[model samples]
Target chain A: MHALSLPTWWIHVASVLEWMLAMVAVIRWGERRGETEWRWLALAMLPALVSAMAACTWHLFDNPIELQGLVVFQAGTTLLGNVALAAAAWTLLPERSQS
Target chain B: MTVVGLGALAAVDPSPLFVLSLLPYLAFLRWAAASKRFPPLALRGFQFTLVFVAVTIAAAVVAELRFGQQLADVDRLHGSAEAFLTVANLLVLWGFSRAEPGQEPPDPEASTTGPSGEQVLSTGVEPAVPPEDGASVLDPE
Candidate 1:
């Protein structure tokens, strides 16, 4: 396993921080607007956070390739993120009226 | 191996910036849907085309910086494709925005009624009734 570079660690840290801030912002905005959809969408940040954490662990352990556990976790997180984004969009946007 | 392949081919290869650019359209769609107000599809399409042109120019600059003068053909093609896709995405977004029902304007008759006994005296109309019982007289019942 190769050693982790400082730049790589910085990127991971930044990604984690960015996602965390996004989660907080979404949740706060949802609460202020009384939007349940936005609140649910905030949950999407969890996966991003998880992926960031796993990446951090991998770097710390000097593992270049992600473990299977990490991959599955991140995949699930990505899927949730997509679903949450779609749902939030649906709730926030106008819907077509059925005749 | 398959995972990396999927990430690169499915996710990373196509300019992530392109997808990011779609965020505005997605936001517009969401807002339009939630508000139950649909704008004209053609107007939306025009706006999208403008954005597409802007993004294409930006992409051309980036390609030039990365590829230098060696890949002029590639740069041009990349810009063209980016512009096409941006326009295409804009069309799709416009369609989505127009999918919702548009709000109708308020009825003119509903807005003409004034509070109290004062009749909305129109031009050339005589004050046919006294002001005290004007509302009761005007009432359909």
Candidate 2:
């Protein structure tokens, strides 16, 4: 195969790191509003963390059925995380007076 | 990342199952775009998603052309695809983090009551107070 294994490994590593950074950034952005907002961000991040873990561990599975399950799980996590993020953003509306 | 690869691996080819796995993320992207809370961010996200998907497909095609239809080669392409998409996501997050959403200030002039605050809103008239003597209150007809 033209695709080398080592470069592929680096790419996966980078992907994980990028996902972590994105989660942190999302949390910090939400936290600027208040603790409640921060909590929402934290909640949103859980699925993403799970998805990342799946991505990291996917290679261990040799069974086709198991791989399919992981794929479904990944899609679910990404969807849940993104929806949570959107909801969190809506919660942190611009220019609401602080209670 | 793993999802995309495993999705492709589930099938012999990379297109059908991988696209299926990616559908949810695409749906989320569209929803976020329509949300209008962060128009620029939403736009950038759309652009990045398109790029990520396009690059992934192109890479998979190139690998198939070069190395025949092998699982390892497809997996490698999936890794690169994931890496690209992850970078795009990170960029989107960075832009989002830089944003400062201001809180809406309460409008002082907009009184809760009508122009004059003395009128009792519920009854649509001034409130009646009884005096100490056996005085008749405002007995309306």
Candidate 3:
């Protein structure tokens, strides 16, 4: 908290909120279109959101040396999130179009 | 044997995770780019996430080299990296938030053709009469 500047905190918080909103928007869009697969896209966004929250939490604590493990956790989640998002997007394509 | 601080090792070794993440992200970009039905704005938004990753990596490297600090400890660098992610999320939200043209509900009063070739609608309009010259009436000469 004290480690990050006011503007830095603002960016962190806004990015998290935007991500959550995007997930909800994706879910709503899928439901509207009657495409159930979009829910998986929203699901795939979770790991990234968790990663963002973990980073923010680490900063909130001023990046304590003891809690540095959060950094690695963030990285792991980021990797998982990227892979999940890719899989979800791939599934959204028609089978005929999929390589 | 050399002693290593697990936390420090974990912190510094996240480069492996970052590198591995790129493989799936590239696959996603390829698929999204090829899919015609994928939302265009959302695809751009997805691409921006890669930009965010690249910026964050560069910022992290700079934090290590210039200040001998982790990116999270460098407030300005961290914030700048996050701003790209915020833009990416905003674009994704904007892309999916709008009602797609095909997703609109059919209007109950909209005209439909009947089995007998008559228009079926509560408030129907007459069909357009074709011109004798076999040209569309709305066509400009």
Candidate 4:
């Protein structure tokens, strides 16, 4: 049985970076327009942050069995983040476009 | 002798469970990316994410079914997955970075002009301020 992997860390770091970039864009636009949608966009990254922290914790301990348990947690976080993204998208109400 | 060390030496292997769970998410991402209301860059970044993750998940399924998790094969497959994920993340970063800050998304039903040229109200209108003097605004001066 294998423990956590580098790809996990890779995805998390990249995701955080991605979220940071998007957050900057959202904040710039959202503040001026009073759009609450950006809040959902920010919240969407919650799982990524949690996943990154968990990966670090697993790294410190280096336990494969423990990691097996942690996989569920990781998956849960992924679900959370993805769900938030979905919500953010919905809040945007893409069908409302005029131009 | 430690799997953690081995994992560090290797990469995160995709599990059947993880891969399958993401299927619905991938569907949602596909839909979101196609939506017109949001910035194209952000949605396009999301599209990149969808492809990369889907690629890895497909690879994992194939590797499991055909290769049976043989050590060497698993290593190759996991490495391949990581490579794809790296590209995916980079695309995500690039796509989002392309978005211009503070640009309002264009509305499909732009402000309409009345017969007398008065403009129709737009979305996100501010609430009417309460009357400080307790007088009805509807009353004409």
| lDDT (10s digit) by residue, model 3, range A1-99 | 789999989988888998899899888777655567789889999999998887888898899876767777888898999899889878866654334
Residue pairs whose backbone atoms clash in candidate 1: A93-B30, A93-B33, A93-B34, A94-B32, A94-B33, A94-B34, A95-B33
TM-score of 2: 0.55
lDDT of 3 by residue, B1-141 (tens): 112443664546666887888898898788766544456677788889889988998999999999999888898998899899889978888877764623222432211211222221112334422233235335657
Candidate 4 clashing pairs, residues 3+ apart or interchain: A97-B108, A98-B107, A98-B108, A98-B109, A99-B107, A99-B108
Point out where model 4 deviates above 4 Å: A1-16, A32-34, A55-63, A94-99, B1-27, B61-76, B101-106, B110-141
Candidate numbers, best TM-score first, in rank order: 3, 4, 2, 1
lDDT of 4 at B81: 57
Could you tell me which 10 consecutive residues in candidate 1 chain A have the lowest summed lDDT?
A: A90-99
Each model's DockQ score = 0.07, 0.19, 0.47, 0.19
TM-score of each: 0.39, 0.55, 0.76, 0.58
CA lDDT of B131 in candidate 3? 34
TM-score of chain B of each: 0.31, 0.48, 0.63, 0.45
**Cα error, candidate 2, residue A36 (Å):** 4.0
Residues B15-97 of candidate 2: C-alpha lDDT, one tens digit per residue = 35446546555654554454444436524753586687788778767777886753334766767676776677666675556
Model 3 segments more than 4 A misplaced: A96-99, B1-12, B99-141
What is the lDDT for B71 in model 2? 39
Please report how far candidate 2 places residue A7 from its true position, in Å: 3.0
Each candidate's interface RMSD? 12.9, 8.5, 5.2, 8.4
Clashes of 1: 7
